[model samples]
Target: MHIPDGFLTTPVWATLDAIAIPAVAWTARRAQSELESPDDRRIPLLGVMGAFVFAAQMINFPVGLGTSGHLVGGTLLAITLGPAAAVVVMTAILILQALIFQDGGLVVLGANVLNMAVVGVLAGYLPYRLAGRGKARSAAIFLGGFCSVAASASLALAELLVSGVPMARQLLWFSAGLFLVSGVIEGAITAAATRAIEGMNPLWIREARPARPVTIAVAVLGAAGLLAAGIAVASSAPDALQALLPGSKNAGIPEGRLTKIVLGLAAMILLYAACVIAGRRIARQRSA
Candidate 1:
C-alpha cells in the first residue's frame, strides 16, 4: 500500500521522511557489513532480487474498495538478501517507483519507504531469525510473508486515518479484511517460492542472524513517529489536513498507455543496471 502524497498530512510525511533518511543510511552500512562473507554469488543475487521485486510490484490485483495490492516482495527479499540488504533494495525500488514511474508520491516517498522497506522487511525477518534452521522453517517463512504485508498495510492505514482522511467504520473493516486475505496469499507465495529455491539451492536463503537491538530500535522509532503523527492528526482540524495534503498536487504520471509501457520497461532496465552496479561496488569493497 503505497500512500500517495495526498493521503498524508504534512507533519506525518515530513516526520517519516526525517526518519527514513538516516534509517536508510544505517541499513546501507549494515548491508555492507552483512555481505562480507566473500560470496560472489550474493552480489548478483542482490540485483536479481531487486529486479524481481520491482517487477512483481507492478502487477497489482484488485483488492476491492477501489484499491489494489501486490506481492510487495519485502519478505522474500529479506529472506534471500538479508534484512539490511533487503532494506537497501526496497529503498531503491521505492525511489525509482516514485521518481520515474510516478506510481507513488515523491513528497511521501519517506513514508512509503518506512512502511515497506524498514518495518515490513524487519517484521518479516523476525520469525525467520527466531526459528533459524528449526523444524518450523516453512511456518516461519509463511509468517514472515504474513507479517510483512500486514505490518505495511496497517501502517499505511494508520497514516491515512491519523491524517484525518475520512473513512467509514465499515470501510476500515473492509480494509482489514482485504489486507488479511492479502497477507495469507503473500505467505503462501513466499513459502512456495522458498521451497522451490531450497530444492535448488538452500544457500540462496540468507542464513538468519540473531536479532539486533539497533535494528529493533530503528523500527520502534519509525512506529513511534507514526503514533505521534496519528495523535497530532487526530487532534487537528480536518480542514488543516486537507490543506496540507495537497503538496505538489500536480505531481502525477502523464496519461498514455504506450508511453507508460515503454517508460516502465526502461525504468526496470535502469533499476536493474543500477542495482547490479551497486552490488558490484559493495562486493569489491568487501573483497578488498
Candidate 2:
C-alpha cells in the first residue's frame, strides 16, 4: 500500500503534506495528555508497537489472484495504544520507511501517513470505542481493522483520481476490489492480536502508568528482534497495488539478509528513541 513517487502529482502530495504535519503534531500533543505521565507505559509501548507494525508490514500474505496483502496495524495500534499515540507511532514508522528503506516515496510520505495513520487509525478506533468493551469489542476490532484498510485504500485511490493519473478509474475499481479481501485479512489479525494482548496484560492497553525500565527494554528488544527475523522471511511477492500497477520507479536500498536485519534494527531503534523524546517533550509542555 506504499505509494511510490510519480503516482501523485506535486501539488496533491504537497497539499497532503501541509495537512499531515500539523495533524501529527496535534496527535502527539493529545497522546501526551491522554497518557498523563512522562513515564506512561504507552510511551515505550509506542516504540514496541511501531516496530511490530513495521515488521508485520514486511511480511505479505497471499490474497489470491496473484495479489498479496500485509497487516496495516493501524487499527491494532489504535486499540492498544490509543488513537493519538497510534498516529504518532505510524507517522514515525512511515517516515523511517521512506528515509531509510525507501519503501515509500519521500514526496508521498505525507499522504501515506495521512491515509494510514491519521485517517485509518481514527476511522477504525472511533467505532471500536463507541461499541464499548465486551462481546461486541471483538467484533468492533474486526470492523475497525477492516474499515482502516478500506478507508486508507479509498483515500489513496481518490488521490490517484484527483492527481489525474493514467487509468485512474480502472485503478480505483481494481484497487477497491483488492482491498475487500485484504481488509478482511486485516480485520481478523486485528481481532486476534487484541484478544491476545488483552489476555496477557490488560493494563498494557487500559491503564496509563509507569512501566519498569527493564520491562520497556525487553519489550522494545523483543519487537526489534522479531522485526529483524521477519525481514528475512518476508515474501518477495508484490503487494496489491504493485500487482495491479507495475513499473513503478521508486528505488530502495538493496535488501540482502544482513542489510535487511541491520536496517530493520536501525529503523526500530530510531522509532523508539523518537517516540520517547516526543512523549517526554509533550509531557513537559502539558505540565507547563
Candidate 3:
C-alpha cells in the first residue's frame, strides 16, 4: 500500500529516510557489479520482463474487506531476473512514484524505497536462491512474495512506533492484518505468474543480466504508468481517504474522478508507446 503524506510523524519519517539513503546507493552499486557485460543478450529480455510486471500490477488483486492491493512483483521479478538487478528496477519504480504522482511523500522516499525495493527483492530472491530448482523454486517464489509484503508492513509499523504515533498497539494489529491479506494475494499472483513464465520461457531464469538503457528506461516508464493508472482507478471508487477526513460528503461520486481516469488512460498510452519503441529497437538489435 502506498502510504499517503501526514500519516507518519516528521521525525520518524526523517530517521527512516536517513537509514535508507545510503542503503539504496549501496544496493545500486551492487546491482551494477551483478549486471552482466553490457553486450549480454539477456538485457532486452529482462527489460521486457520488467515491463510485463509493470503491466501486470495494473490489474489489482481482489483482497477481501473492501481493500485491494496491486502486485508487488518483487518475487516474480527476482524469480525471472536476479535479486540484485530486481532491486535496481524496483528502486526506479519507487523513485518515479515519489517524483511524478506524489503517491508517496518525498520526505519518506528513501525509507519507502528501502522498504519496498530492497527488502522486497531480498526477501523474495534469497529464499528462492537458497532453494534448488524445481518445486523448491516455486515454493521460494511464494514465500518470497509473502515475506516481502510482511517485511515492508512491519517496517512501516516500526516507523510508526518510533515516531510516537498514537495507538501503536492498535496500529500494529491493523498493519499486520492489512499486510497479511495483501501478502496472500501477492503470493498467489507471484506463483501463477512465475509458473507461467517457467512454462513459456524457462531460459529467463538463466539470463539475469543488465539490458540496454533505452529498453530499461521504457520498462521503468511502463511500471510507473501502470502504478499511477492503478491508483487513479482506485481513486475513482469509494475512497477511504475521503472517509478519514471528517466533514467530507459521502454523497454521489467525487468531482475529480473523471479527471483521474482520463489522466490514467493518457499515462498508459504514453508508457505503451515508449515500450513499443524500445521493443522495436531491441528486436532490431537481436536480428542484427
The C-alpha stretches of model 2 lying farther than 4 A from their native spots are 39-42, 58-69, 168-171, 207-288
Across 45-141, the per-residue lDDT of candidate 1 in tens digits comes to 6777788887876777665688766677888888887888899998988888888878779999988998899889987887676554556678888
User: Who wins the TM-score comparison?
Assistant: 1
**TM-score, predicted candidate 3 vs. hidden true structure:** 0.63
For model 2, state the Cα shift of residue 5 in Å.
2.5
Task: Write one digit per residue (lDDT tens) for candidate 2, span 1-288.
Answer: 778888987877898789788988887988888876666766777788789887887887776779876778988887777778888998898888888988879888888988887878876775465453444557878898898888787677657655655453365467668788778989987787778788998876643223235434434543443353234223221233333434532546564556645665687778877845654444344334
User: Considering TM-score, where higher is better, how would the candidates rank from best to worst?
Assistant: 1, 2, 3
If both were scored by lDDT, which would come out higher, candidate 1 or candidate 3? 1
For model 2, state the Cα shift of residue 196 in Å: 1.9
Of the candidates shown, which would achieve the greatest lDDT relative to the real structure? Answer: 1
Candidate 3: worst 10 consecutive residues by lDDT? 236-245
Candidate 1's C-alpha runs over 4 A off are 37-44, 56-70, 210-288
Q: lDDT of candidate 2 vs native?
A: 0.70
